[model samples]
Target: MSESKKILVPLLIALIIVSAFVSGCVDESSTSQSIQPQEEAVTEAETVTETTTEDVTEKETITVTDSLGRVVEVPKNPESVICSGAGGTRYLTYLQAQDKIVALDSTEDKVSVGKAYAIANSYFEGYPTFGQSGSENLEVIVSLDPQPEVIFTMYTTNGYDPDELQDKTGIPVIALKEGDMVQNREDMYQILRIMGEVMGKEDRAEEVISFMDATIADLNERTEDVSDAQKITCYAGGVGSAGSYDLMSTDSYYPPLYFINAKNVAYDPAAPKVAKVSKESILIWAPEVIFIELRPSQFEGENYAPYQLENDVSLNQLSAVQNEKVYGMLPYKFYSHNPDTALVDSYYTGTILYPDEFEDIVLEDKAAEIYGFLVCEGDVEKGMSVYETMLTISSTPVFTSLEFD
Candidate 1:
């Protein structure tokens, strides 16, 4: 965060009157920088809203530089918008601005209830599908009713260029970075602030940030005193990436392990964060415990890593497998990181690795607490209900010990 960026952000106030845009004097004022709307017009049959982005205007919009350093002008309190990436909607959920989302991206519409955020807010499925993550359907977008006032995209570099997308759709496009929960905390925090400014949820964004810092501190506080000799040697397998992977696919620097101070057997200071290792490597490392990423897709076939864990004779020889310490991890990546679930997994990991220190904690209640704050807007009953639904959907008790046939 440079001083210059801070200067641009303070100008993003929430008090801008949205009704001013309705009177029609500012017809071409949807975005500053004078970008024109797409030339391809939808026919009358497809025109849900006769007035497109070309007609949608705000009496006032503040200029804020996005994660990519593109200066975008968005309504101070945009009530109608489309979050343009799979994970972009996650931030809005944290901010309690789901009501602001007028339409869904392809992933949100198609894979409804697949992630913790989505499960907690299943009503999003009722919204019209706007576009896919990265690329959007410009025709459908420009024609939408309660027309989108701004476009917030998380994966800016994934597909359509933010500037080009704005130029084509005639809507302001705010690019956001999908920063990781670990290591990239600042990037993630910056995004929250940017969104908070746009949606007038500044205080809520800070609340989310404070919760993350305090929660991580509490996690470290619990196990920081554990000596190296007492640490549990662990490995996380079947780590999901671009495609399906078996047991050999893993991350040495898995974030949840760091939260609980689990010593990873595959950890190497110089190793790539993610890698595919040989079965022989696993035999030699012989981690005392192993965690596999649990996903609905993995349950579909015998070819996935979870299946390999049970069928592989050499793998069964490992101490962890013999001791029945193999566990299925709750879903971590849904399109991208769910900070809520990441914290939930961290607490669960602490309980498993340092049970005495985490003795007072109940995993289900902890998960509910996190979900309640992040998605359910402090509704514990709703959060707990969502958590129960997540568990049933996992096909097994993924957050706990597992049985393999």
Candidate 2:
């Protein structure tokens, strides 16, 4: 309890502390180093976990087999895409996915009015164009703001190489066939399904397919009972393919004719799908009912074939010309064979070939219904307005040839 005892006790405590450090029993620096590594280990573990999660997010995608048979991995439910070839945009429009279109081919911007899908989505005129029809400008595709995730191209030919396109744009590209509404119906449906699968619209794809199926079935059933003897021999001429052609341009197997049970007088087992019939050949196999496509030139007063029919007295010798059986069908081959117009053409042809069966139908109403369901998702109000807009660009199917008024 004295001053000397207090000093001795403090000196003894200091020595004990120094001796513990000298013996390395409580090495503070070693303990500090050990705690630092544990902290770093926890930080490293967190960094690894964060990086793994990011990799999974970056790789999230779905695999699709395009019409070209190319397997591609695309981002799940891509919100933006480019429809790049002939009927590529049309198929997307048919699936009611027109909103997904980020850019279009310049051809659509130029020929916006005539193509049915183009007509339905006229606002597309304002969207950036990727390139010309059947050909895409990869530079523009890649430079698009908010870059597109996928590209749907049709008719892979005409200078469009899907593989090269996909490579250059770094965007997944899907190629498709311009399959017809008839014989190759399944191919067309399959293309829609593939796209729908990629876009997460599988149900919509099936809905569109079922509508087409029901349409084809309805057309066939309506004319099913027409006796082969009673079925009129008909011909479709002035058909558009690649570009406009003269009156003699026709397609054998002329898809819609088969659906309506018309014995196409031009139906050739050996001829190319599209053939140029001679004026002389026409005289020998005169078709009783003639359906014609009003080419774009015709609207511009070129009157390519119709001028020949009305003025070429030699052609007047044909029954179709003389009896007024020649009718104007919608330009079904705009861009590609427009399935909606094909069906409308078939129905109109049916009214002429067998009116009693189509007596309950109104052509305008039916046309609107077709456009509404196929292009507008069964929204007839929108379909009705679109139909009116369509009339400005295309002839209403029905009426003697060249009589759009």
Candidate 3:
């Protein structure tokens, strides 16, 4: 073969090999590009499915039985809530779950001025009001921007039903019976537990109950050995519902008197729990010691019961008034019974009734300790001024005589 022929054959073979390699590379690249888009589409679809499933799970509802024995469906985690009736907001505040409160009753604004729970949580003053007790503004509640998920209220005497309220508002209404904290302590504890569950503060609720248990135990330990005859005969005055004070307003089942084992002259099992007695009865009881409920308006000189007791001629002849056994105590029934304040009042009562037994307890220091636990976030000094302003040595003169002007 000639040189030219040899070169042309080799060139032709070389060209064929190059063209085949290029075609194989193009086919592989096309296959890889087609597979990539399919893989990406599968991955995106999986992500969307997972997100939808998670949202559905979060919206799931759980069934719970309220204080009234009604089984209702409530959100797994309630984000917003409305408190109605007496002591409704107080229970929430005790749990430190005030952040969940979407709206408050009008009474909260007035009571929050000097009250321990109210004074500690002044932010609640700005939230919208949902009307007063026995009258809740359903329209305003529904119009709330985020809308509340649950409603907590006390059982009323006028036949207000939780089931009916729930139906009307399309929100879960849990009715709790505000039983006497001293007589029906378990009921109060159950109420706290239920509220804690609703507000996601179960641990905090347990803490409150434990504190109450510890307080009662401590009081009993100090007074257990004292004889019944040694117990001071006492009468509590100026006690009423929703901050209303009557000269004869009193409760037979008052917890402070009960817990401290003091002999309550007004206690009669047959009589109503709370009633306004005749002035003649006050003379008849003639208690050795008289505890007058201090009012916020005493400074304003309007409807001050302590001053009324001081000036009343009929009460002057009594041993309590004659011997200066009359003392001022924090109003136990402002809006509703304040368990924390009531506990503190018991210590004060115990200290006065039996000075020797409670000698180690400084009333102010004890009050500060309780305030720290319940209202001051464990800071003993932080809400002490509010407590201090409630009573003073001149006001609550147990051993000393008050030289009134």
Candidate 4:
């Protein structure tokens, strides 16, 4: 019962209460601190997920097949492209997609592609030409100006890498398989379809393909079931070369030859490389019909020369020689494997193979009709002159009586 003692007891009790409140606040703060680490971990995991998504997006890729049988994967749509295949560069001209082409090969350099060549040469006069020396040089290809975004090589010929080329130069490699020179229009259309997809000119590509399809359909209707008896066996080649020197086989775009039921003197193997025949082999095969691919140099213009005919033998011994079934095709204009010329050659082969079936289908008149499709007006008079020149040496003089005009 002293007043001072009572006051001390109450003060001690108040201090204990304050201590308990402070301890409770500290425990609650510790719980909040425990939750903070979990929130930080969640945030870090979200950031990692976003980064992974970005990486995947950056690594997105696409693959395309080339003229050869190889498949190539590239970054999205390529801007600049280099074509290294037989008639590969012609696609640009066919589609009017020259702006996409950054470089071209030698055949294109020689202006071998007719109007397409002229147009591209005029447009890309300053661009480097790579395929001129019969082969490709990797160094020169790597040194191209404004380095190409994609390098497209032929499946059979162009020697380049898909992944390696990309790793070295950061450019994708595309394989554009070159169809057989004598391929049918359906095959050519498939090729065009692939080309259109690569060049981003699908509409134009389809248009050309449809036109070719119509042309081939018409040719088929005209020459279906040509007589086996009428089907002539043709032998062709350069004058001096003894190796394979015939026109294209089943692998080439000259399907019209097959359509007309004609047989080439050269036996087509399971896998054929060239469409030629040799002299020694020619002697053995001795075709029923002879077709010499007469060039401007070999056969002088309008005059089928007085050249030696195998040991100066009389023309009566050979079947074709006796019957004067020998003829000459225009080696210059009709020799190419381009879309335009291929169709012309197809029609030409059909007519030659089954003249009876195609009796109404005059060569010069058909040539003129095909001229519109070929994007060039072939000279009918020039064709007759070539035919006459081929028949000049014949003892029988078969071409002399035929009315070419």
Q: Say which candidate scores most in TM-score.
A: 3
Candidate 2: pairs in clash: none
Lowest summed lDDT across 10 adjacent residues in model 1 is found at 32-41
Q: Relative to the unseen true structure, what is the Cα RMSD of model 1?
A: 22.6
Q: lDDT for each of the candidates?
A: 0.80, 0.78, 0.78, 0.53
Clashes of each: 0, 0, 0, 25
Tens digits of lDDT, candidate 1, 1-405? 999888766654422444455544466565532454332334543574655755787567788889999888887798798888857788999999988888888777655444777888888878888668666899999999989999998855578998889999999999888777766789999999999999989999999999989998999899889999998789888776666557887877777887877788887767776688899999999988888877775344565677787888888778888888888776675566677877888888888888999999998898889889998999988888878777764564587777665
lDDT of 2 by residue, 1-405 (tens): 999999999999999989987878557777988999999999999999999987785646999988878899999988899887678788888888889888887777667655667778878879988787456677788889879998888755567588877887788888877677766788888888998998888999998888888888898888888798977788888787666555788888676687887888888777776778887877788889778776554443333566667667777778888877788766777777788878777787888888888898788888889989988778888877776666665443434454321
TM-score of each: 0.83, 0.82, 0.84, 0.59
Model 3 residue 74 CA deviation in Å: 0.9
Off by over 4 Å in 1: 1-58, 297-299
Candidate 2: residue 278 lDDT (0-100) = 88
Which runs in model 2 stand beyond 4 Å of their true positions? 1-56, 297-303, 394-405
Please estimate how well model 2 matches the true structure, expressed as its whole-model Cα lDDT: 0.78
Could you list the CA RMSD of all candidates, in the order they appear? 22.6, 5.9, 3.9, 12.6
